[model samples]
Target: MSVLRRVGMTLGLPVILLAAWWFASAGSTSFFFPPLSEILDSLVEEWFGPRLAADVWPSLYRLAAGYALAVVVSLALGVLIGTSRTVRALTEPVFEFFRAIPPPVLVPIFILLFGLGDGMKIVVIAFGCMWPILLNTVEGVRAVDEVLSDTGRVYGLRGWSRLRRLVLPSASPQIFAGLRQGLSVAIILMVISELFAAENGLGYAVVQAQRSFAIPETWAGMLMLGLLGFLLSLLFRLVESRQLAWYHGLRRAQRSS
Candidate 1:
């Protein structure tokens, strides 16, 4: 498609929706549903204003820390489980049990153990997000071609060399798929953790605004959240596309045929 057409295709629905919302709520008198323009104005004045750093920075820090920790732990555990039958057999049930549990149900336990601090929230987010990455990696590693494994063994690729040179590359696509899912989960948990107990965060801001009947601020927070989610997803796909460019190319070629 032409650049203009592609842009239109991507933006058409959003534009229509925004226009409809703007027109419909131009003179909104509802306490809960303020005008879109007012919401945008509040978004700019509050989020873009002095309170920005106070609310945003802490949340970002916790999210980054939690996500990074989960990625490392999940990848390590996944590799171990995927490679070792003994470990997999021993731990599969435990992992499944934990993964099956809803994250919110464990919030109280986390809070009691770690208090309403950043550490608890970070751990909660990490716990909530790690399952997808770990499981995906396990499946990916186990699914590697036997022929390729034999070929690598023939070449005497052993230990870390074999894992780095063969296993990780083979499993990267699936690992990344898991990572994408984990990222979405992490975002949700980040917000939820903050909502449950936080001195500051975007989620806390949203909740506080609603409780105080600051309808415009509440809408502003929602807009900020939507924008953040979109931006993060976009950034994630950019990274994934780069890393899996070869996989994407092969798929495209197959489609063309």
Candidate 2:
């Protein structure tokens, strides 16, 4: 199919489904599933309204802070362990044990330890985001071509110079793949933390709307969360495309060979 046709099909599917939903639920008055139009109206009112902006900012701030910390810490540790066999062996079991545990299970512990404030939420988000990044970084480092390492050594590049010039660039694509995975986890944990115990956030808004039986408002929050996730993933893909342009070019050349 043509690119424009493909794009039209993609956009048309959602529009069709939404139209069907709006029409199907037009006659219903149940709180379980509000009409699509009503939900859209509520979304516009809540998201575009001045008062709701306060709640949105706090949630975004916490998410950004938590995810940023996770990226820095996990990437640093992952690179360190990835480069050192001894360090990787020493930390493997502990990392596996923690990674196996579901993030939601730690919510109560975090709340107890850090209270019901922003600290607990940030920690939870970081905890959820770290594993994917760490594991991916390790894989990325391991996947670096042995020939590249030998070439670097022939040039007398060692230690930090080797890592900075050879290893990191080679590993960047896989590292980015892990980062994309971690971003989704971060968003999930962010909402879950807020849903469980938060005074202000999109998740809190959803809970409040549900409690009040405002079905349209609840749907609006859910839609907003989906949009947020989509936007974040798209942003990551744009960055990945630019950062890994050389990798893509190499792959294209290999395919033609």
Candidate 3:
């Protein structure tokens, strides 16, 4: 399809739904479900200026730091564990135990350890984002075809070179899957972390608005979050498309055959 058509296809449903909401709520007298137009006005007034710096930027910074940290650590540890049956066996129980615990439940402990600052928030976000990526990486590394390993060995690929050229590339599909999952987790954890002991953040803003009975402002904060998540997911898709172009091409070819 053409670019315009594709764009229309993508946006048509949301636009339609938004229009329905706007019309449905046009004459709303309800305090909780205020008119959509009023919410939009509040969204513009609240998020369009100073809050961008004071609230949004800090949240984004924490998300990026935490996500990057998770990705790096998960990939390294995943590769190490995947390469050794002994290590994997030894750590499997511990990994499973930790993974079962909800990340938010540890926020209190994290606050105690790191204080109610950026450090605590970053750790919470990282911890929440780590499991999916680590598990996927381990599985992906372990599932590499033995035929490919033999081929690499015959060509003198060994140790670091083998992992660099063969293992990583082969495992990348799963790695990207984990990264995508981790991104969403990181965003959620960012807000959850900010909800507690926070001076400023999107989540904190929403809480403040609700506490003050500024219903429109609360709705606006939520709208901002949805928009932020949608935009971030789009950006991630663009990156994934570029990174996995070859894999996609191969899949297309296979399917056609």
- Model 3 Cα shift for residue 214 (angstroms): 0.7
Q: What's the TM-score of every candidate structure?
A: 0.95, 0.92, 0.97
Query: Considering every candidate listed, which one attains the maximal TM-score?
Result: 3
Name the lDDT of candidate 3: 0.93
Candidate lDDT (C-alpha), each? 0.92, 0.88, 0.93
Task: Please give, for residues 1-257, the per-residue lDDT of candidate 2 as tens digits.
Answer: 69799669656886897789889988878768777888889888887574267677788888999999999998899899998899999999999999999999999999999999999999999999999999999989988899988999999998889889998999898899889989999998988899876889888888898999888888888888887887887678789989999999999999999
Q: Which regions of candidate 3 deviate over 4 angstroms?
A: none
lDDT tens string, model 1, 127-231? 999999999999999998999999999999999999998999999999999999999999899899998868999889999999999989998998888778878
Model 2 RMSD vs true structure = 2.1
Report lDDT (Cα) of residue 201, candidate 3.
84
lDDT of 3 by residue, 41-66 (tens): 98898787778888989999999999
Which rank order by lDDT, best down to worst? 3, 1, 2
Give the distance in Å from residue 184's predicted Cα in candidate 3 to where it truly belongs: 1.1
Write out the backbone clash pairs for model 3.
none
